[model samples]
Structures are given as C-alpha cells and as structure tokens.
Target: MVLMLGFVTIVAAALAAGYLLGRLRPWRRAGDWAADQVRFTGAWVRGGVVRQAVVVLVHVVTAPRTSWRIMRTPAADTTAPVPVRDPDWVAHRTRADKGGTP
Candidate 1:
C-alpha cells in the first residue's frame, strides 16, 4: 500500500510539473518545434505512400495487358533435334533445371 501511494504521488507530481512546464514560454516553443518536425516527417511519409500507390496502380493497369499480349503470340517451332556436344553437362543441366540434387 505504501509503495502504491508513493507511485501515485510520483505520477501526480510528474504530471503537475509537466503541466506547469508546458505553460512556460521556452517549453511551449520547444513543443511547437517538435510538433512542426513531426508534421514535416508525416508529410514525407504520406508522399512516399502516395508514390508507392501510384507505382502499384501502374503495374496493376499494365500487367494484364502485357500478359495477354504474351499469351496471344505464337510459340516458336522447336521440333528440330539439337545434338548435345556433352552428355555429362546436359544431364547436369537437366537435373539443375528440375531443382534436384545437382
């Protein structure tokens, strides 16, 4: 109980000191300066957010059209047999492409 009272008294005293200091000229000026800095930082953050949103919007608008163009294009004919110069390298390449132990 004594400890609790001590804590409450300390909190009240701190609050009162803060209230009195906030009324002083220097403290009020400091608070205003801090608020201005916060506002400046907030504006920068908002600008970055807006720029990211615009980039995402552009990607959203272009992605489907780009994908559709790719899909509509004819695939190249690859029926001709290409001779592998090195069978060992070809086996390793195939294994790597399949994401197996290479």
Candidate 2:
C-alpha cells in the first residue's frame, strides 16, 4: 500500500539522518559530551552507593560487640519486671484452668 511505502520511507530517512549525525564532526562531539555526562552521573551514584554500603557494613560488623558491651554494663538489669501496656485485658478473659468466668 502507499501508506506502508510512506512509512518505510520515513523510517529510512530517520535512519539515514541518525547515521549522518552520528558520523559528523559536531554531532560526534555532542554525543561524546552526552556520554561523559552520563558517565559522571553514573559515577556519582556508584560512589554514593559504595559509601552507604561501607557504612552499613561497619554497623553490621560492630553490632554484636556493641550489644555485648551493653549487656555487660552495670546498668543492664535482667531481674526487672517488664511492664505490660495492656494489663486490664486479663480481667475480661475466662480462666478455664482456675474455673473462672469472664
């Protein structure tokens, strides 16, 4: 069909334009500049990721030692009663073991 031929012509023209632009001197310089910008952005992101990974690795490596130190401290009390946030809920339940009802 004529429409299909027109579409093919348009695609071929676009390809030829792209090829010429890619091969020409000024466009090649522009392409290199664009590539450098992408390279710099990628490097920046990579550096940030590496820096955060190092920070996480440090925390992971020191966590056990930090926990052990806190556990061994004099202020760490094991015999303290843990306070419940919902102590009143026990009164509403049935105590089958003690033969008590709600």
* Cand. 1 Cα-lDDT: 0.60
Q: CA lDDT, every prediction? A: 0.60, 0.59
1-102 per-residue lDDT for model 1 (tens digits): 999999999999999988887688664464454444333445434667675454334433445464356458897787668876865775557666888876
Please report how far candidate 1 places residue 29 from its true position, in Å.
Answer: 6.2
Each model's TM-score, in the order given? 0.26, 0.27
- Candidate 2 collision pairs: none
Could you tell me the lDDT of residue 58 within candidate 2?
45
Model 2 residue 55 lDDT score: 39
Cα shift from native, residue 92, model 1 (Å): 99
Worst 10 residues of 1 by lDDT: 30-39
